[model samples]
Target: MSAAEFSYKLRVYIEDTDAGGIVYYVNYLKFMERARTEFMRELGYGKDAIFNHGLMFVVRDMAVRYLRPAQLDDLLEATVRLIDLGGASMTLAQEVRRGAEVLATATVTVACVERAGVRPQRLPRDMTDSLRAARDTNGN
Candidate 1:
């Protein structure tokens, strides 16, 4: 579970909230996805490279816990860390935080797949190597 964390910040808009001005629960997942995208991009796996490699990642499983609500116009940050690296999948620990308060947390497993048939594919070596470098476990 030890990994370097990356964070992305965004503001909650009216469209992201319900009639009562509370952020819709599903939007949290979107924020986490953005964070993961940025994390990978920072590690050199931009969207183009990933797609050009004939790979697409899909969420295989997710577990989420909601603790607080983010209202309209509120600033929120989504943080992500690579937790597990498997042959064809990886796990991410993500959190949506409003300032210092954690609003939601999630554990998501993403499967690497062939873009056309959705068959499982091996993870990119560069991606895996960078993830291992960023791993905080025992100072790597």
Candidate 2:
């Protein structure tokens, strides 16, 4: 995959927040995860299709920074951008925002692995092709 940023829109709900009505810190990761999943889905790999191929993607590492607090009922957008794609791993940059305000940002690395043994595996050719096409369409 190349450097194409994708955005997913979501609304903060009660379940996403703390008793103080602010979104929990870890939930930002979840929001970014959702954006990445949607990005794959847009490339024609839905959740079931992704895992059903006998291989699945797993988070290998991540670093996050919290910038601001998001309140319950806030309309949010999460974004995913491919920073690098390797034979068996990919790095993504993500951000969660409430309108113009960024709440958090993360850099995540995920590895493609066999589901059964959890061993690293190369990404499928078709998936890679589709991602490349998307990147080109998005201007790189």
Best by lDDT: 1
| Residue-level lDDT tens digits of model 1 in 52-127 | 9999899999999999999999999999888889999999899999999999999999999999999999998887
User: Mind sharing the TM-score for model 2?
Assistant: 0.93
Residue pairs that clash (backbone atoms under 3 angstroms), model 2: none
Please, what are the lDDT tens digits per residue for candidate 2 over residues 37-124?
9999988899788888889999999999999999999999999888877899888889999888988999999999999999999999
How far out, in Å, is residue 35 in model 2?
0.9
- In model 1, the runs with Cα more than 4 Å from the true position are 137-140
Pull out the clashing pairs in model 1: none
Q: Using Cα atoms with residue i matched to residue i, what is each candidate's TM-score against the true structure? A: 0.93, 0.93
